[model samples]
Target: MSVTTTSRMRHLLTYAAFVAPAVLFFTMVILVPFMRAILFSFQDWNGISSDIRWAGWSNYTKMMSDTGFLKSFSFTIKYVLATTILLNVVGLLLALVLNLALKTRDFLRTAFFLPYVIGPVIIGFIWQFIITRLFSEVGKATGWVLFQKNWLSLPDYAFWSLIIVTIWHSAGYFMVIYLAALQGVPKDMLEAAEMDGAGRLKRFWHVVLPLIRPAMTINLFLAISSGFKGFDLNFALTKGGPFGTTESLAYHIYLDAFTKNLFTYASAKAVLFFLVLASITLVQVAVMKRREVEM
Candidate 1:
């Protein structure tokens, strides 16, 4: 081979050396499993046994009539919406307050964000103990009706409990995103707004909000996806109790696959979930990106 040919071959080898591991892992871990899932969704297999029957569209069709799946779908939608709204709102509020020049702002930020660093399962179990045991004790001592009621035992309260815990667990992370965006806002713009006689709310609404739209986009995406995929908290805290009112889509899918041994049906549901999540997040990013201001 000539010198140019040898150099080109060497560069190709170098590039392959860098890229081959990622491609190989992707094929093995993600692509293979995804293809297998698609195949499984079309067959009647209980995750075992070689007697796989071709299910065709039956699993997909069964979802329409499966009331448990439908109820879980509804609950998941509500949970996503509630957590998305509240997490963003609470996170923004916390970011705003912590952005101030308070002496304890650093400590407060760390304190608030500390929970997010903990595993979701651990957080859920801790909160479960607080709600189940500590709350009862406090209620008995203080005679407070709020703590007296079993929050996890009531359907409505159980639903809100998931929301509350999700927000508590995740809001700090969102706050960090917002805080970073807040810090990146141009000081002169805020001063200009104030000089124009804009009040604090006006300055924030007109100036800061638009400038931080990118952060909003990211936070919204994370919140929506996290809320949709929520399972750890449901598992550790409620276990889809209170008449199964708190069952998230992920939890329901888990039960169908593991508990009921409906492997093919669960695969079908998982496929639908992936599509829905992809569509919603794409639309959200598209719309939010349009609103995002440059510079």
Candidate 2:
């Protein structure tokens, strides 16, 4: 081979070596399972039986007529809205605070992010105990009747509890993302704004927010997707109790596939859920991308 041809072949080999592992991993884990799910969504498999009958749209039809499925769908939407808003708001506030020149800024950031580092399963169990048992004692001691009730036992309270837990877990994560974006905001611009007699509120509204729109886009997408797909925390906290009021789409999928053994139906629900999340995320990205202003 000529020298140029030999160099090109070497580069190709190097590139293939670098990409092969990731390509193989994705094909085995993600692509295979995704393809299986699509196939299963059209079948009547009980998750165990060898007789996999092709059911076509029957699973989708059954899901539409199922009231429990509809309730879970609505509950998932409520959870998504509440948790997304709260996560972004709290995360932005925390980011703003940490952006300041505090003495313990690094320590405080680590402390806030500690909850996020804990496994979701452990966080769920920890919060479940605290909300159910520990809060009762504290309430009795402090004479706060609001905390005296079974928090996880009541539908409304349980819903809020889930929101609070999700926010507590995720806010720090998004805060870190926002903090990085905030750090990128030009100090000269902020100083000029201050020199022009702009108040802190005005500067943040006109200067900081517009510059940090990219981070907001990312944080919003993360919050919305994670909120809609939340399962472990809700499962551990309430298990969709209080007359199945807290059941989300994810938990419903779990119940259908595992608990009820309706694997094919659950696959259909999963496919629909995936499509809804994808559409919403795409729309959000398109709208937010337009709003992003270069710093």
Candidate 3:
């Protein structure tokens, strides 16, 4: 073979050697489990028996009449909406503040992002104690009704408390993304807008927002997906308690499969949940992409 051809072959082989492991790992870890789950969704298995009966579409149809499933899914929708908005708003606001030429910007950035580094289950347990114990003591001392009530025992306050913890846990992650996007906004454009007598808010609305649309797009997708698929916090914090009002779809799936021994039914619900999530994410990304280009 010619020297050029031989050199090209070695370079291709080198690249393949580096990429092959990641491709293999993903296929084994993610793709295999997903395919298996889809198959299991249609089978009547107690998750332990040797015989796995094919139940066809019964699993899918079960969701329509499952009150617990419906309730959990509904609550999840509310949670997703609350978190998506709060995380993006809070995250972007933090990013903007930290972006300012403050001497403590680095420390603030690290401090804000610190919570996200901890495992979410740990965060849930930690918050659970604070809300139940610390808040109760403070409430008794100050005679504040908000803290005195059983925050985790009441449906109205339980989900809100969950939202608070989720936003606090995840806002920093979104902030780092927004901060990167904000930093990429052209300094000259911002200065020129200011020179033209545009006020700060107008400058941000007109100039900064449009430039950071890409980041906003990504952040929205992250927040929505995370909120929808949230499990750890819900599992650890409330355990879907207070009349099952705070149970997320994910937690419901676990409860059905492991706790209730409804593995087959849970598998079906999992499949449907997968479809709904995939659809929402796809539609959202498409719409947001169009909006980003327009802005």
lDDT of each: 0.93, 0.92, 0.94
State how far residue 65 of model 2 sits from its true place (Å).
1.2
Give each model a TM-score: 0.96, 0.97, 0.96
Task: Say which prediction, candidate 2 or candidate 3, comes out ahead on TM-score.
Answer: 2
lDDT of 2 by residue, 1-295 (tens): 8999999999999999999999999999999998899899999999997999999999998988899999999999999999889888999999999999999999999999999999988899999999989999999999999989998888899899999998888889999999999999999999999999999999999999999999999999998889888998978878898799999899999999998999999999999999999999999998899878443
RMSD per model, one decimal = 1.5, 1.3, 1.3
Clashes of each: 0, 0, 0
lDDT of 1 by residue, 27-59 (tens): 999999998989999999998777899999999
Q: Cα deviation in Å at residue 266, candidate 2?
A: 0.5
Which residue ranges in model 1 land beyond 4 Å of their true spot?
Answer: 1-5, 293-295
Q: Which residue pairs collide, candidate 3?
A: none
**How many clashing residue pairs, candidate 1?**
0
Q: Name the Cα RMSD for model 2.
A: 1.3
* Candidate 1, pairs of clashing residues: none
Off by over 4 Å in 3: none
Per-residue lDDT value at 96 in model 1: 99
**Compared to the true structure, candidate 1 yields what TM-score?**
0.96
